[model samples]
Target: MTFATFIKNTTQFLFKAGFIFWLILAILELLMPGFVIYYINMQLWLIVVCCLAVARAFLCKEISPPKADAPMAQK
Candidate 1:
């Protein structure tokens, strides 16, 4: 596997896993109310931000227009 492929897969995995993990944490917090659980639940926002950043990075990596200095249009 190439480096690009690995990065792409990893970022996608992170997004999916983070979403699922947040859901699980939310469920646990709801089922068993406590100070610790509430604090842990607060981290869901952090997880969401991280997942969005990962997704943005992956998309940015995949989207790059041709460089202006490389060449000019033939037509």
Candidate 2:
């Protein structure tokens, strides 16, 4: 796969993962106090990394179009 596609996919995956992590953490905090507190900092860093990756993906150039030499369907 192309670099742009790889970056885009990676960012998407990370975003989903981060979202799920926070959701779980929220549930845990509601059930128990001080538990999962250590993960707060780590989760924040994950958010930051995901944000940076998304930014990079947006800045990446669009994929090139197919070449004319490729085969075409016959009528």
Candidate 3:
């Protein structure tokens, strides 16, 4: 496989794992009160910022405009 494909798949897997992590956190928070309010200690804001940055990078990569062809010489 090409390096670009490998990188894309790895990023996709990471995003899936991140989704699962948040799902588990939400479940725990729902099951036990104050789970998010007091128990968690990591820098959630930093993580959120990083996630948004990565997402934006991928978005821009996919949404970039098509390159225009060179114009033909005038007759």
Best candidate per lDDT, number? 2
For 1-75, candidate 2 gives per-residue lDDT tens digits of 999788777777776776677778777877997787765665675668678566756755468897789677798
lDDT of 3 by residue, 1-75 (tens): 988777777667666676677667777878987787486643584486468558746743776577898898899
Model 1 scores worst on lDDT over the 10 consecutive residues at: 35-44
* TM-score for all models, in order of appearance: 0.54, 0.56, 0.49
TM-score top scorer? 2
Sort the predicted structures by lDDT, highest score first.
Answer: 2, 1, 3
Write model 1 residue lDDT over 1-75, tens digit each, in one string. Answer: 889777777777767677776777667777877734646545766667586766757564755677779577798
User: lDDT for every model?
Assistant: 0.69, 0.71, 0.68
After TM-score superposition, the amount by which residue 19's alpha carbon in candidate 3 deviates from its true location, in angstroms, is 0.8
Q: Over 4 Å off in model 2, which ranges?
A: 42-75
Supply candidate 1's per-residue lDDT for 51.
69
Which of the predicted structures, 1 or 2, would earn the higher lDDT when compared with the native?
A: 2
Tell me how far candidate 1 lies from the true structure as C-alpha RMSD in angstroms: 6.8
For model 3, the superposed segments whose C-alpha errors exceed 4 Å read 34-75
